[model samples]
Target: MAPLMNRSFTTANTPGIVHIADSAAKRINSINAKAASNPPQAFRITVDSGGCHGYQYVMGLTKEINPAEDVVFEKDGAKVVVDKVSLDLCTGSTLEFVEELIGSSFQVVGNPKAETSCGCKISFNVN
Candidate 1:
C-alpha cells in the first residue's frame, strides 16, 4: 500500500505571520517602559465573533500562556501571541497600535481573511 500525503487547506494568500508597525513598535516600547515596574507575561491578540461587521479584534495582557497558542511576533520585549485558529484567520496580517483624538488601541490591519471592514474600522467581514 502507498503512503498517503498530507494535505492542508488555508485561506487567501496570507503568510504564516507578521510583525507590528514602526509606530506600533514605538508605542509598545513606551508601554514596556511603563510596564517595566509590573511587566506582563505576554500580549495577546484575538478575534472574537461580534461587531458591527461580524468580527472584532481583541487584545490584552496575559500572564498565563496556553500550550496551543503560537507566538507570531515580538519586539522591544513586547510579544504577540495568537491561537492556532486565530492565526489561520490572521495570516499575513499586521498588528498596529493607533492613537487618535478619540482613543488609543491595538488593531489588526491587512488581514487576508477579511472580506470587508466597517466604517469605524473596529470590525470586519471575514471569508
Candidate 2:
C-alpha cells in the first residue's frame, strides 16, 4: 500500500497483519515511557461492535501476550499486538498516531474495507 500522511509503515510477511507507521511507533514509545509498569508495555488493538459507525477501534497498553491468540508487530522498540478476531477486521490497514487541535490518538487509516467512519474517526462500518 502507498504511504499515508507521508508516514512509512511495515507489516509482517504473513497476511491478516496490520501495519504500523513510523509516527505511530514514535508515539507508542513515548507512551510506553510514561507507563507505570516495570517491564514497559506494548500497544494492543481490538475492534469491537456498537459504535455509531458500527465498529469501534479500541487501543490500550499491555505487558502480556497470549501467543496463540495475538499477532505482534514491531518497529524500533515499540510493539503492537492485535487479537486474531480483530485482525480479520483490520487486515491491510495502517494504524497511525495523529495529533490535531482536537487531540491526539491512535487511528485506523486507509482501511479499504471501511465504508464510512464517524466524525471522531474512532468508529467505522465495513461491507
Clashes of each: 0, 0
As for candidate 2, its clashing pairs are none
What lDDT tens digits, residue by residue, belong to model 2 across residues 1-127?
2223333333444458677888899998887777655666888989999789999999988989887788877777677888888888888888899988888888988887889999988899999
Off by over 4 Å in 1: 1-15, 37-40
Predicted structure 1: clash tally = 0
* TM-score for each model: 0.75, 0.84
* TM-score, cand. 2 vs. native: 0.84
lDDT tens digits, residue span 1-127, model 1: 1122222222234346756676666676677678784654566778888898888877776766665455436655555677767777677787788888998877888998899999777689887
Output the lDDT of residue 92, model 2: 82
Looking at candidate 2, the ten consecutive residues that score lowest on lDDT are 1-10
In order, the Cα lDDT scores of the candidates are 0.68, 0.80
Question: Model 2: runs farther than 4 Å from truth?
Answer: 1-14
Which is the leading candidate under TM-score?
2
Candidate 1 accuracy as TM-score: 0.75
For residue 45, model 1's alpha carbon misses the true position, in angstroms, by 0.6
